[model samples]
Target: MNDTSRNVSFTDPWIYCLDHGYVTPMICQSTEVLCFLLGTPALVWCLWISLSGSISGGLKPTQIFPMNLCIVELLFCIEGLFQTIYYLFLPNNNMFLQVVYCLFFIAWVCRPLFQTCICVERYMAVVQPVAFIKYRLRRYRMGTSTLIWGLAIIYPCFTVSSLGYLTKTNDVLVSVYCLGGVVISFCCFFILRALKQPGPGEVEGGRGGEKKQRTTDPQKMRAFSIVLTNLVIILVSSILVAVGFFTMPNSGIDFYCNTFLMLLACNMLSVVVSPVLHLHREGRLHCRKGPVTN
Candidate 1:
């Protein structure tokens, strides 16, 4: 048998335990398992909605952006499920395992970048309707989507291979955090700016000689409000993760629990809540009565 003694050490109790043939903590295992279970259902639902052409009103070009976002989230969550299972069941896979874990981390990190793009697209639709419509032509949308994905993947790859670092401490435990806080912060700032912009196609018009002012539609305003709420959730979650890393002492139960749960919550929240909110806003939840028109 492989020598498990080398895995355990005094500094990192968790790794020591794993190395000494003890199971990972019940709470950690349970949380990971639950994340996997929840993520699976959420991913399946997203895929079903994306493919059914019912989620965003028959695959309109505008809807394609969010649908692509859904696909990325689904793929990331599915990869997360596999990583959780592998960690729980096969903890000692060494370098190959580390590479797999890093791949999963890349997916996790790329999610927010894609989300920021989605927010930008929505902002354009509302604040620059003319430009948005022009860009919705097939060639432009396809080319833009391709560019976004390429940049998202390539940037992270460069960071991970360059300045990004992942390592075990003297404590011997492994943590898979990365250093893209600046990117995340920049994304949040832009998304917030987009959210604050006025709705699309506002023009001034008035009775008699006076021009009537163009204004945002109340329904569209409500949709923006929903998007704003989701953005706040994401921003707050990202902030908490950053704070936890910087302020909390390393290798503590509270630290690990908070950081892991925060990230897991952030990912799951976008996957599970976004579609529901969109459905609600579009009145699709009442489809049994009749199909909701967007």
Candidate 2:
């Protein structure tokens, strides 16, 4: 009888509503406002640095890739700023909210896609020098970047357009929740492949008189480090969200808090951490030289 009563309570819509009532609409508004206030200036700074082009020097390809990643981050951050303001100020307008949510999803998902491409570029630079040099021309790089952006946009747009129709069903919601699982698995697979491969300097000894060494290439290590770091962020946040949604019937408090934290962590990855990682890796943080010279 007690177990039956507990199940009944858990399944009741009123009970769910009561449990989550502490997360008022006003609090959501305030949180969005605060996130926007902190994100805008950072976005502008990243853009300014990217446009200055002062960092374009030796290893232009390598330097420009980070700048490209920074540009993507800046764009996403600006989008996030708009999203936060929209959600905070006009929470009840469903049409506008829907548009903002769409934009938010696009920007949110694209950040990692762009970062993945950057990783692949770095891997190519270190692992396939001859091919990398051959394709290092401005036209080729620009074309490649365009292709990546197009694919990223197209993939999600198609999925959203088709799958969104089914979101009204409970089963569809569960399937939609599994989307992050697919992304996480794919990213981890590629990152592991990149890590296992030998880097550029690994095969060749330093010099005739120098000792043969097995040290990891700094660039490759940095590439691996960045990918692994972001992967951990994405994976942990996704898991938290999944657990929250899946276990919501059992514990509404845990579900709400974990979901909120997951959303915030994912937003931080898209808006803050991505650019910071690029800036730090490129040595642009302290240098007044505009951007980091690749």
Candidate 3:
């Protein structure tokens, strides 16, 4: 067995592990194929939407986040697609395992960090509307996007400091980091909910559809919903990381492979899911003439 992969990882060709769950070579190969299939359509859909989304005037500012997310996910899908190919045909290339892990680590970390950034921006829009509007979103979005990517790019440098070595501990730390981000997102979600409390002008219509107005603050409400969707995505992705961490292939050989396989496959999932969720939530609101929606 290779030094980079231990008992319950891809290198393990057997079935069942007490710790990581059931995952033989066959299971691993099948999971990779499944991810490739799901990621393909998601990649195409995200690309088309991102490209078209920019044309809508109201989507100019807001589209940046989803577009970026979709693009990143597309890269993720490509990575997984190549991985499936590698596993299926390049069985002799065992030396590249660490490289794959490095790429996956970077992509996994990026997913949550971007979502966190989205939440923070939405928070500003909701908590401080005047400042958000007056300050202009384009310049700040550019800066924020650069900063987040800068941080994400450099993150792998420290984690894989040895350059040639990859460790199981790296995965655990990434999961922990993701869990922390999830907690922060949860706090953001709560703050959004608090702001959504019924206040003056919040009530809409009566039983007979009287001329009662709707919404306490439409902008704030919209921001709230956007953040909520992001929060849900963050939570699910983070939970998967947590499970992978706990079920790491440290002990049992056969039982643990499933968790490891799931972890690897899901590294491609957030990219697909995040874009789809964003579109489902805000697709209709991106009017071409209105202020750049976010």
TM-score of every candidate = 0.62, 0.57, 0.68
| Model 3 TM-score (2 dp) | 0.68
lDDT tens per residue, model 1, 1-294? 343223222124445444444433444455445655665565566557667776456556665666667667666656656656566676666554555545555465556555655666765665577988877766666677787577645643554443323332211111212233344345445545654565446556467746467576665565556666766666665555545444334344433443444544554555556655555545556543322555
Ranking the candidates on lDDT from highest down gives 3, 2, 1
Model 2 lDDT per residue over 1-294, tens place: 332224212113323433556453334344445445655566566656656665463335555555665666555555656655564476466566445545555555455455555555655565566977887777766676677577645654554445432132223323443565565556565766767676666755667845466667666666676667777665564455455445544444443443543455454544555555556666666753333445
lDDT score, residue 26, model 1? 43
Give the 10-residue window scoring lowest on summed lDDT in candidate 2. 3-12
Off by over 4 Å in 1: 1-32, 54-59, 151-164, 167-218, 244-254, 257-270, 279-293
RMSD of 3: 6.6
Compared with the true structure, all predictions reach lDDT values of 0.53, 0.53, 0.59
Candidate 3: segments with Cα more than 4 A from true spot: 1-31, 55-59, 94-99, 134-136, 151-164, 168-176, 203-229, 246-249, 263-271, 278-294
lDDT of 1 at 166: 38
Report per-prediction Cα RMSD to one decimal.
7.4, 7.0, 6.6
Scored by lDDT, model 3 comes in at: 0.59
lDDT of 3 by residue, 148-230 (tens): 66765666556554542344545645665566576556668666776777665677777697746666677767767666666
